[model samples]
Target: MKQLFISIFFLMNFVCCFAQEINDKEIDSLYKEDQFYAGVTYNLLGKMPKDVSQSGFSLGFHLGFIKDMPINKNRNIAIGLGLGYSANSFNQNLLINKDNTGSTIYSVLKDSNTFTKNKFSSHLIELPIEFRWRTSTATDYNFWRIYMGFKLGYVFAHTTKYRGDLGKLRFSNIEDFNNFQYGITLSAGYNTWNIFLYYALNPIFSGDASLDGNKIDMNAVKIGLMFYIL
Candidate 1:
């Protein structure tokens, strides 16, 4: 019994030591080459209707990978492709005051100012081709980059939730959401990683008489961590 106990203890200790050594070696050998990383982003759509105060901004979280090429000892560049999913929401509370026949009472909310919320969400596949300049080694990597790119996507899902004394109302457009959409991205960052800001000029919808301009714009600002895979 004593001999067995001693053997088991030695075996466990040996395994632990081996694992620790392997972990350190793995980290030391790792470099920013042909590696993949993912992160989150926030989108703020400005230039909204004057009467309507923007309540919801689009928020997105994504992951991507890059293939790097070394140009010289102090310079390198990389290209990457990634797929991500994102959701956007907008909410606002309005103060509606109406005077009917000398009697003045604030209604629930209506007309230009309404107590309601509109939300949009979609899943997207994005491809990013970025150029980077860096001074990093296998042990410690550091650099910065300027990336200009575009994303082409379609809305997979959409809905508008209107709640008031009327109870609840929901609208969904499976056809409209799939419409072709494109956006441009211009960003500057420090290190191989980048913080990007992007805007979409096209509107997802056309304004109709009933809804003025139900047009939805794809505008957002995103910040994420990036790595090079060569």
Candidate 2:
């Protein structure tokens, strides 16, 4: 997945550069700022179910294109709408299995601690809308920027993988996982590198998933660095 993002990054970059060479000069009053981006994040599970604990590092990769429309005369303030892709993984102690009837079983992973891996992953198609502010000029190559946004994504693919004492087990397209997720995001910093944060507004799992007659509820939190390419 990481390799996929890297390929997208380079491909988008080449396209952008080629487009610029075809029309290298722009009217300062109508110029746009960075419009391509890629990021890496440390994924965290919030509001975890009782006894649930993360067992390994969780990571995420993202890449996208944004259409920047300046909102003010200075061309320093803008609104951006974008489409992006993200892949994320969360490693935890929550055990998921299926009964003979193919009904999913949920539990706090039990003894032997024999399991070597237990993780769930999601791949999303995302839409992001942002209000942006920056201290920049049409000719400037570096500047400070702040972007506040709302993002919504559709989980088109998902899976769980485990290996260890129980041998190998895998689950795909879990019906209990929420198909849509929404979040609030913030990204700010200097040229090239920026700090990015996202917090989900809804749980990742549906009520059909439970651990003690109560539903399992949890959301995602991500913190990372983002790189923008003009």
Candidate 3:
């Protein structure tokens, strides 16, 4: 995590320097614009135990509105503030259980009666902020862009599910899951298609949540495509 942050810091610096080298007059001629963004991503668990593994595809999707505010006289460089909603699911072998003491515990399910399908899902309201650069003109719709940002999310709903010969079981509004999440995001590409990456800065579960008496400090990583509309 420390190394990741260090790399991001240097990347941001490089982008800023590159932006400064562009022609000021040309940048000034571009118009500032607001946009709507929607995306679908594949989610992966990061920093998880080797014994705990994903069983199937983990998916996520989000939609949002962004208000762009230009920093320089040239509209090519701007800061964007957005409000969005996101939902994500992870299909894994870990089972979420409540112990006799009423504490949440994550355990690897492995037995004759072990679950055939297990998943954990979360829904969040998000606020995203980004520093953006684009090579665009008022008349041109196709452009290359690089956006680096962070998002703060509040989990409004969470669920855990299990299914097998023992029958299906589900628990909603799990109290042990972390209610707040934050992450760094990057998007870059040309025209209508963009590649997106997100790295969570916080764990998915609260510090008190444990797996085999060890804190389950797992973060989420997502990669996918994003589309923007003016």
The prediction achieving the highest TM-score against the true structure is 2
Which runs in model 3 stand beyond 4 Å of their true positions?
Answer: 1-30, 111-113
Question: Least accurate stretch of 10 residues (summed lDDT) in model 1?
Answer: 103-112
How does model 2 fare in lDDT?
0.86
Which residue pairs overlap in candidate 3's backbone?
none
TM-scores of the candidates in the order shown: 0.58, 0.88, 0.83
Instruction: List per-candidate RMSD values in Å.
Output: 13.2, 3.5, 9.4
- How high a TM-score does candidate 2 get? 0.88
Better of 1 and 2 by TM-score: 2
Candidate 1 lDDT tens digits, 132-209:
444455654334556566765656666655565555655555343435556776545554345656566665443321
lDDT of each: 0.46, 0.86, 0.80
| lDDT comparing candidate 3 with the true structure | 0.80
**Reference-based lDDT, residue 171, model 2:** 98
* lDDT (tens digit, per residue) of candidate 2 on 27-104: 465788768878888889999977888877788888899999999998899999999999999989888889999999
Candidate 2: count of backbone clashes, pairs at least 3 residues apart or interchain: 0
